[model samples]
Target: MSVENKKLPQSYYVPAQSPWPIVGAIALFFIAVGSGLTIMQLNNSNVSGVFLLVIGLAILFVMLFSWFKDVITESNNGLYSTQMDVSFKQAMLWFIFSEVMFFLVFFGALFYTRNLSVPWLGGASNNVMTQQILWPDFQSFWPLLKTPAGDTTQAMGWQGLPLINTLILITSSVTLHIAENAMKVNNRRKLQTFIGLTVVLGGCFLTLQVQEYIHAYTELGLTLQSGVYGNTFYLLTGFHGLHVTLGLILLVIVYARILRGHFNDQQHFALQAGSWYWHFVDVVWLCLFFLVYVF
Candidate 1:
């Protein structure tokens, strides 16, 4: 009953050994090294590190493209099996778990800043000059507005662009659900429509996010260098944006495979993985909207 049971003598489905994954690992190594050196050089006045970082990132992208192309080709050739499906599902689940841990680091930083760092700065402990030296008028609140460095910024409320983006992302998750359900029922037209709509909605959410960033940086004068608040804000939200971009790319690939008559009703691991990623992104955005913007 399995796809592999219908195959030929060999039990190998996509038995090809890919060199690109190893190349990608190498590329990431260079990128990490280059980035570390670049940051060090910024303070030490050394310029060589940035060059390495750029080269590493370039190689990494190339490796990723080549590797993804190979997988796509193998998948289209009907070389995947139920075992492959389980593997993909496990991979995606672990991937999302890793992402959750990544965000937890930022959330930990936020908690430290709010509950400890800011309080210490305000002379909560035995240090009297802490208040005299810095943040004399600082009030410690959950959604930080006045930074310890005396840089003031208006906290982004949840009612405007943030709310709209939240709704858009939630709607996208729903549309992706519809697409997955359509795939289950073997409705290619409905699948394509829902998937395409979800992609468009994702694009719109990203565009709005860009606009919000522009407003924050330019209009509101709240930049990454503003203070600790800006640093955490940008780090969390910017990384989320990058994930959304990757999720959209995955959705596009699934849509392309659908059009090529791939991913039958009984076996569509690619679509399922992409849907999981999209939903993960959406849930992260929801947390960000409440914690970062609304508090």
Candidate 2:
């Protein structure tokens, strides 16, 4: 039930056609244009790339805040019913499914590079002539530290910050679960405490991630320029970091709503959806840690 107090209505409620969709589309357009220009500006001296990017980001922020406000208002006003609740659940599930596919593409790239391309280049099968002509001295390894172009870099290990961050994320999942349980029992204090802990844990993960990046760039000489190894490494972990950041933002919003008592056990889809997204993020990280870091 989307609204706890409202009696279930037979007629489905449809929101009026709103400006948010168009506003979101406009914001995406600007962001797309800005991203392209910014990438192009990397070579040339174009300044509008960054300017448009900032404007797009601002519009996006406004849209998210206002759109969420509208939704929350509608929800609290008992304008929603079970139909609306089902729609929200389906929407969230599909959104997460799309995100999974997005990451799947990256993981596929990693697989193709490591399992097929690298091995074939290293004279696997009868491709000895191919290796001889292409990269005669290339020593095929999982990390591929030394590139055929003679650029060398160190692989990031699963020790220290990476390991600690992995533990932090796992613990966050536990805390979020406890928070959900507390909410179910109407234990506001426990709910707030655990959810707040989840937020702090998320922040700590991001902080450590930044530090890890710094160490990679400054000390390890691992960067985007270090051939396919660096490219895949950064692409996988960097995008995962971005997802984590987004998940943290969601958690913060849910926490704020919880503080306002916007959610009781019956009317907590927002928190439930937020938790679902966060858990999905955690699963992605686990895959990244094992496949990208441990192995």
Candidate 3:
């Protein structure tokens, strides 16, 4: 190794205090409050909630762009040492782990409601009296499409758009893997092509998902107000859709980085992180496909 290379610090690079965190928190606060108010005002004529939601999202995008710009500048300037790279890797790992736990909570709720709570309400085990007195007409079902409150929604099937979206996401994962391998071999042309294809696949998946939501609401009468079935269905799938949107954004950023000649075969932590996240999103979709649709 060259002497200059050996001179690279073993300590991590800690950037000076930044306002991005606070800005991000403020953006999220607005998003949460605005979303709540917007949903509440859905039947009303007021548009203030929608305004705030847009402003919040705009601020969030600005914050993300500025933050990533700073990171990219530092990275290209070689401010990040080996230790810093390890720290970044660890941070990405933990972030993905936290996301897994976050989704697990919602999945756990679905499982509990399906296996225990609904069954109990429908007279399973020793709850015969409960069912007879409270919900005599309610039948325990995996989907619980017809709630005790009489609200009904058509169940989303696994075929058609859902299956197509599944194939798109799975294929995107494969493309991303190919992109990563191309990056490893320093084949920038193949890397850019594969990653660009992955981005297109992601966009297709999102388009299909939106179409599916429209079909659910317009054709099947499945909506957020359709009781437990609709609630769990939308919540789980909605959050996953948001994740896919974020993943698409990340992949786009990575694609831009590739175009700018940012990453090479040796040091491409940003690409690696983005690819890791994309893979995680793909895995989560597989789980959702099976649990929410098939099972």
Give the winner by TM-score.
Answer: 3
TM per candidate: 0.83, 0.90, 0.95
* Model 1 lDDT per residue over 1-295, tens place: 9987795653447565778878988888887899778755755667789888889888977886777788878877878776777777898899999999998888888878878887887678865587777756766555566655566786666788889999999999999999999999999999999999999999998999999999897777677666777778888888899899889988988888888888888888889889999999999998888878877
Give all candidates' CA lDDT scores: 0.83, 0.91, 0.91
Residue 216 of model 1, lDDT score: 90
The lowest-lDDT stretch of 10 consecutive residues in candidate 1 is 7-16
What's model 2's TM-score? 0.90
Quote the positional error of residue 157 for candidate 3 in Å: 0.3
Question: Cα RMSD to native, each candidate?
Answer: 4.4, 4.1, 2.6
- Comparing 1 with 3 on lDDT, the higher-scoring candidate is 3
Q: Supply the global lDDT for candidate 1.
A: 0.83
RMSD of 2: 4.1
Sorted on TM-score, highest at the top, how do the candidates line up? 3, 2, 1
Model 2 pairs whose backbones collide: none
Q: Which residue pairs collide in model 1, if any?
A: none
C-alpha lDDT (0 to 100) for residue 45 of candidate 2? 83
Assess candidate 3 and give its TM-score to the true structure.
0.95
